[model samples]
Target: MCPPEHFEVSYSINPWMEPDKPTDAPLALVQWDRLRARLVSLGHRVDVVPPRPGLPDMVFAANAATVIDGRVLAARYRHPQRSGEEPAYQAWFAEHGYPVRQAGFVNEGEGDMLPTGARILAGTGFRTDHRAHAEAADHFGLPVVTLHLVDPYFYHLDTALAVLDHEEIMYYPGAFSPDSQALLRELYPDAILADEADAAVFGLNAISDGEHVLLPQSAVHLTESLRAAGFTPIAVDLSELLKAGGAAKCCALELRESLPSTERRREPS
Candidate 1:
């Protein structure tokens, strides 16, 4: 995780960003610290990459890269505002002994690529291009299930859905194209459908450690629903960070060892 030492929404790229809106930097830092503490408390190891000036959104480390097995496919952001972040993230991976691979396509890393044990759910239409999914399939040797996001509010797949292991998923269907929604139903019929109110507040962006779920404090209903499903919910107030279009899950990067070598899933010709 990169510290929010220099975080500010100086420019607008998505519907959630507002350059005129004021952000509470101090509050953002405190919230980040609490998130870090919560992750550690839940028995997860935390890593830090020093924050750099002019790269405020670096705090959203999930956009840094997509790591499958030990190979790091660094992000090539669509916006110039975030493109500078690619080299820094790549450097961090190299420093930590992970092999960094150059991505030949435009992809926003984990922001649009979510691994669901059985497959990688890749999102396109906003931040990531469909071509990136093909590149990822070749690089990681995992089946890439592509979904197109239609709602501009849910620019990234991670913003619209959260993969809770391979069996269960919670998502906002309205954020997806009708075809994608149908595909989702075909893939996971019993997936938890997030309500509009909670989804608007980025509730579906919550992080689940299998047993414990870290979500936005405002998602009261989602919390209860999670409990009913036998998962403990930990509400965290990342309101300040929300101003810049990220919350609990968006700020943290999930690191993994190299995926076991496997055959590639179906790719578009």
Candidate 2:
């Protein structure tokens, strides 16, 4: 049963994160409560956990992992300090009624997974690795498309690319590899391009609902594009999160499941 492929998606709370280089920029506790409230209001069932001390950035706990089918595939984080998250994640999934499975492969939670349609794209090379790509494809029946990580701090795939609607994926090409481009083209022929600089300004990491895309106020052209495509765009100020390298989008929300999973369909990564 463990080897057999199965399931879709679910969401969870992020612990918190701290920057390694910056000593002055503190991780705020007040923002976390507000973040939790916002997500819970969106009708998500949130399960919060306290982060262990000293690991200020530990709250952005990749150990929490993603669930597809009935299985909890443990995420393999690139940072050594994050490796300890797996044991807890595996146990959490099993206890929560999900079939638990360990992935020897390394991956970043948000960065590695692009689960849509029947295809699931897994990002590697920066916060994740090749082992992750192979394991995800083989174990989960999802074709793992590898995305190359470019730029130093754009450590996760979510940093440069995001899938908005079934047919739309937002990308920052400067960070893409040749293989990544070809793979994306095969899956999405009509992908709208958002420049790397623009994407870095919170253009690409924007999240989506069936009729709306929540974007940063700064993305004028992209916002217009969304409206033209019949989407109501909501803007939120993610200045505090963005200052810490997160966007208005990535800082809080998790794409847990598509209500009508069959209608939206899944795309390969």
Candidate 3:
């Protein structure tokens, strides 16, 4: 995990960012510490990637890459603001001895790609280019389920949808195109739908370890729904980080797959 020591809105690219808005640096550090402590306390190991001075968005590590079966498909960001982050993350993976494959197409790593057990769910239409989907398919040898995101607020697939275990999926329909929404309905008929109020707070941008779900504290409706669905929902207040357009799941989590036993224990927590 990286600290938000240099996090600030120097420029605006998405709806959540504004050049005039200032981030609470101290509070962001405290919040990040709490998240790390919470994850560690939950029997998960935590690792640190030293934060760089100018790359403020390094705290949101999920945007770094999409790793599966020990192969790293490093990100190629669309926006120039985040383009500088690619090398740092790629270097991290390479130093750890992972095979890092440089991506030719534009993609934002886990921000647009998520492996939902059976198939890979990929998002397009905003930050990630559609050609990246084909690249992902070729790289991973997995069938890619392309879901087009329509709303500017839900810029990434991770923001619009949350994979609950292998079969169950939760998402906000309004963020997706009509055909994508219909595709989702057909794909996961028993999927949980989040209302606009909950979705607005990024309720669907949650992380789960099969049973326990760590979500935004303000998303009470989603918390209760998760409880009813037999999943444990842990509320974490990441409001300070949210000011920069992300929350607990987006900032702290990086999902990888099929690592050697040693690297698996050290890399993912």
TM-scores, all models, native as reference: 0.95, 0.75, 0.93
Q: Summarize candidate 3's per-residue lDDT along 3-62 as a digit string, tens digits.
A: 788877777778988778767889888988888888888887676777888887888888
Off by over 4 Å in 1: 258-269
Taken over the whole model, the C-alpha lDDT of each candidate is 0.87, 0.56, 0.83
- Stretches of candidate 2 exceeding 4 Å from the true structure: 1-27, 61-63, 248-261, 264-269
In terms of lDDT, the poorest run of 10 residues in model 1 is 260-269
lDDT of 3: 0.83
* Backbone clashes in model 3, listed as residue pairs: none
Query: By the TM-score metric, which is better: model 1 or model 3?
Result: 1
Question: How would you encode candidate 1's per-residue C-alpha lDDT over 59-82 as one tens digit per residue?
Answer: 999998888777888899999999
Better of 2 and 3 by lDDT: 3
Using lDDT, rank the candidates from best to worst: 1, 3, 2
Between candidates 1 and 2, which one is better according to lDDT?
1
Q: What is the lDDT of residue 179 in candidate 3?
A: 98
| Candidate 2 TM-score over all chains jointly | 0.75
